[model samples]
Target: MNQLPFFITIPLPDWLTERLAVPMHLHDDEARMRFVIELSRENIVCGTGGPFAAAVFRAADGMLVAAGVNSVLRLENAVLHAEVMALMFAQARLGSHTLRTGGGIHELVTSCEPCAMCLGATLWSGVARLVCGATREDAERAGFDEGPVFAASYAYLEQRSIAVVRGVLRAEAAAVLDHYRESGGVAYNG
Candidate 1:
């Protein structure tokens, strides 16, 4: 007979926790994207996870709620993408299944455009805005399979009232992806 685990835990890397221990309150999109990009770069340097990172922030004051890096390799789980991890942690931190119920609006800042699964999670995450750094082409060029995300998919999110911003700090964000590829980082889904 096969055995199945009743529960699972996705542990955050020690470096990430230590970095986030200090409070942060970014004031603009560029700053937030830059912070998220740094997290992605550090994830690569720390060898804890994939070269991607995301954070959830309170839109009103730009206070970080939670941040997470891709832990697919670290946790040995395919669904542990950066965006998913961030959302899960943010929701857990807020003690709510959806971010909408919080007193303030929330936003998700990511170092790269979300893949198909992350996009779906973003929709259900109840964040008022989704800000992306690198483009899908950038990720694909870095040997990542970003799944079937179409322009219409973004339109769908907009239709549902989720503000979407893309290509923030493009060169900087894509450079991280390039660095990861040049360093021979594993493109797990490629």
Candidate 2:
């Protein structure tokens, strides 16, 4: 009989490490979305994972907390989406299960709108803001299923005190998804 593993490890690609070695302080929404969009594009160019990326940042000062690219195909875990990975890393880095602590407020920025699982995680992640680039329609057009996200989803987040901002750089972010589809990228959820 095969032994059962008790622990799970999700590793980021080496290129991500190299890219994050520099200090990043994006002071505005557009800058942060552009950075996340670049990471999504690079994820495709490097053939590492899905064409999606997310980052958690200090809302007050624009200091980066953590960043992640979609690792579903690479890590063989369907739940390892970019937003989940970023929130996980951010929680680990801050040594708290929730980001709403006395230290400071944080925000999550993603290259594309989050799916149902990621949106649920965002609410539990305790981030004060949720910033998105591309829309669910953009992802769907690229053959990806966004999974039950709707206008009420934004309302739910807002009701929970999480400020939701969408379409920060829609054109650039949607272009990445289009490029991924054109280049024969797999839509794991489709």
* lDDT by residue (tens digit), candidate 1, 6-40: 99978899999998899999989999999999999
Per-residue lDDT of 1-190 in model 2, one digit per residue for the tens? 8699799999889999898889889999999999999999999999999999999999989999999999999998999999999999999989999999837999999999999999999999999999999999999999999999889989999999999999999999999999999999999994
Error of 1 at 165 (Å): 0.6
Model 1 residue 109 CA deviation in Å: 0.4
lDDT on C-alpha atoms for all candidate structures: 0.94, 0.95
Span of ten consecutive residues with least summed lDDT in model 1: 1-10
The clash count of every prediction, one per candidate, is 0, 0
Clashes of 2: 0
What shift in Å separates residue 94 of candidate 1 from its native position after superposition? 0.7
Provide the lDDT at 36 for model 2.
96
